[model samples]
Target: MTLRLSSMRKGIRRLAAVDVGTNTVRMLVVSETEEGFRPVIRMRRITGMGKALRETGAIGAPEFAASLDALRDFRKELDRLGVVEYRACGTAALRESSNREEFLAEAARAGIPVGIITAREESRLTWEGISGGGGTGDGTLLMDIGGGSTELIAGPGKRDFVSLPIGVVLLSASFPLSEPPRSWELSNLGHFLAERIEAGTDLWKRRRFRRMVGTAGTFTTLAALERRMRIYRPERIDGVRMTLAKVRRWEKRLAGMTEAARLALPGMEKGRERYIVFGVCQAVAAMERFRIEDLTISDAGLLEGILRGLCGRKGRG
Candidate 1:
């Protein structure tokens, strides 16, 4: 077999990063490149950790089993890819889970050490990922809706960010929507989200941003749905623009559909059908609260941010 000259370089490092979120576990394996880094593999498993927490107030047996299986699979991939080092970090789900320690211990047993990151650190890493891609200008607001939390970051100020405790999993569990959610139910959910966003973002409300960027699963899924993508394509979804009117339109349409109907849609992810409506509603509410007309979609999010940090550290060493 012939090897590329780049492979012969000294200190060529391959790294892995795992993001354990409220609803999903995502892992990225990347190898260094002169331009920056190239992804070897990107994988996500919907483990429903946050859903269990939201419904049962802890990590249930089923959720724990699913999460451990995902982590163990990720560990196998890391080893197979010959990753020099890897970091596995947990987010809001783990932070709020009553029995997270047991899960964390089991994750370690599976060869992945899960460290729960603060909301602030999550916001910072998210910012680093978005800004590193080099499209967002100054004062660009970023909205990242996860299963357990939503992070809003605007401007370059050190403290210009807020992480709300509300997310799609929690909202779906809290609000019992009919097959087609009633208008009043949607109204109540909107009010609930608006109040929390308003209370948490007093600083951002007083200011304005050049544009808004949306990241994480919610935004990416919305982009895919908007395009009616039969196959999920990261290259195509990234940098897509979604207007507020269109987002609201999607919210209404989705709200009116049954879970089966939503799942049957071309672009809907398998595990997200039950809660995607809430995510869309949250997006609409956030856009209205921030008075932004449209938002740009960013596929590179927290997972990419984690990989960036690992690459940087490898470079320094």
Candidate 2:
């Protein structure tokens, strides 16, 4: 049975989930009840895990160190919070890492066994995360713009899904544009992004999606920055609506600023400055390609999906 938004409150109690990605590691603790799952705690650390991924094809010392520290902290929290039900999953960065096993072993030592999810699994999780949240109405397309890859899943039924390798961190390394990225550079970047998305599926053209829901860091951060938030407030970002015009406006505005200027902007994270340009452009490209006029930004994603999975798959080794 599909877990509808209203039904998410049933089954299980306290659940914890961790999502390790190319640029960030995040943990969430929630309690499922009659109303819905209310967040007990949320923690995120920008580890820059994929900064050198494409160039090296392995986890480097700096990023790996960050991961170890983050995972260790996450484990401590799970213990302290008395979270018996939990799941930790890794995405694109770990999927591409030659030394991912080493990282996984280290994570296990911290009391959290990390599983690298397949792109298909990632897409399904993302879709579940969105659908379970209840904002999609009849049906909506969910897009998760990650550092190492972009996952798009069309839903209500999740009729189609695809995970593209063109992520913000990877694009940043591939296209080293000058500070205040030039028009030609942004154009080229947009084209490259659109080509991949276009080639990803014909579903967008054939099926009429009612709405678009964007998940992951890129979308949420953009929403935060638009509001000029000094600190990220998930409540303020969740279910917030953004139009394609706003996406383009931010794209142009950010492209005219230097790296330092981008960092100085409210809601901009220091480690992500290098990739935000391309990341924002990719979001813009997606909205245009899908012919979506507006989108709802979602702060919930893989971690939430993992938690829901744990609640559903109660008995497992």
Candidate 3:
């Protein structure tokens, strides 16, 4: 559905999109431009909303408080910027949590009413974000490695998507790895990731993508690390490509480092050191599973896709 706002008659419309995921809360504010949209501000916070879901079956106290605080800050930003239209979505952790309503209620009171989206809907929005409402005519395989789930989309239609239950946060939490992870632990993690991905994509076994494109935190963070950029520039990270060999290299190197050592790396995101190894393992498994040799990074994902939808430029997938 196309979203046309009468407010556009007055000229450029300011828009905002928030993604409340299992591990992080991110908000993007942009201004409509003749050339699509120009970012006004991008903010992210690692709230670890799914930190203890496996053991507790609910959002933990620390994560719940931090998430609400982040949303409150976003609310202030939106109000200050005079954002005309906005959409905030909650993903897998919220979808599966036993006490999601409590957290959702608190989030709304904090000024960000988040709608819990299904896995498939998350896949569609992710695809829309990567392609910018433009359909992928080349049969590109899109992967979004989120905190609680990983979405693999292969076609320009809604039916050809799979949201795998395994993600970095859940995977790491499910199997606690020793620092400088042991070989057996890495092996077990690899086998688990492979089996899960294979089972999830069995329905599309006959299909193949011309190329694989990875979005969300994992891929972009990997790109930033590869470049060793102390200050991340999205323009440089987006559209960058990496071969399977390079991916595997990082996987081995990172898996051998202690959390502190990893944190000391030039481009590692502060709170991501604990889980970055698992994230790379997931990427490597995906590459091997799909028989793809290289992966491309898309800095844009669900948030950007949400903005496009608000602009009335409906995405194709």
By lDDT, the best candidate is 3
TM per candidate comes to 0.93, 0.91, 0.94
Better of 1 and 2 by TM-score: 1
Give me the runs in candidate 3 sitting further than 4 Å from their true place. 1-12, 313-317
**Candidate 3 local lDDT, 1-317, one digit each (tens):** 01222232234568899999999999988888877887878888998999988889899999999999999999997887778888999999999899999998998899889999998888888888888777766758899998899999875576779898787889888989998899999999999999999999898888877678999888888998989988777888898999999999999999999999998998888889988888899999989988899799989889988887888753311
Residue-wise C-alpha lDDT for candidate 2, range 1-317, written one tens digit per residue: 00112222333466788889998998887776665567877878888888888899988899999988988988887776667678889999999999999999989998889999998888888877767734456557788999899988875334578789998888888988997788888788888888888888665677666668899888887988988888777888897888889888888888899989988999887776777888888888878887888889988878777777777766532
Estimate candidate 1's alpha-carbon lDDT, on a 0 to 1 scale.
Answer: 0.83
Off by over 4 Å in 2: 1-13, 133-135, 156-159, 315-317
Q: Compute the lDDT of residue 311 as modeled in candidate 3.
A: 80
lDDT of 1 by residue, 1-317 (tens): 01111232335578777899888888877787777777767788888888767767898788789999999888887776678888889999999999999999999999999999999889888887778745467658899999999999874357878989887888888888998889999999999998998888886667876668999888898999989988887888899997899888888889889999999998898999888888888888888887889789998888777777777764421
TM-score of 3: 0.94
Candidate 2 has a TM-score of: 0.91
Model 3: number of backbone collisions: 0
lDDT of 3: 0.86
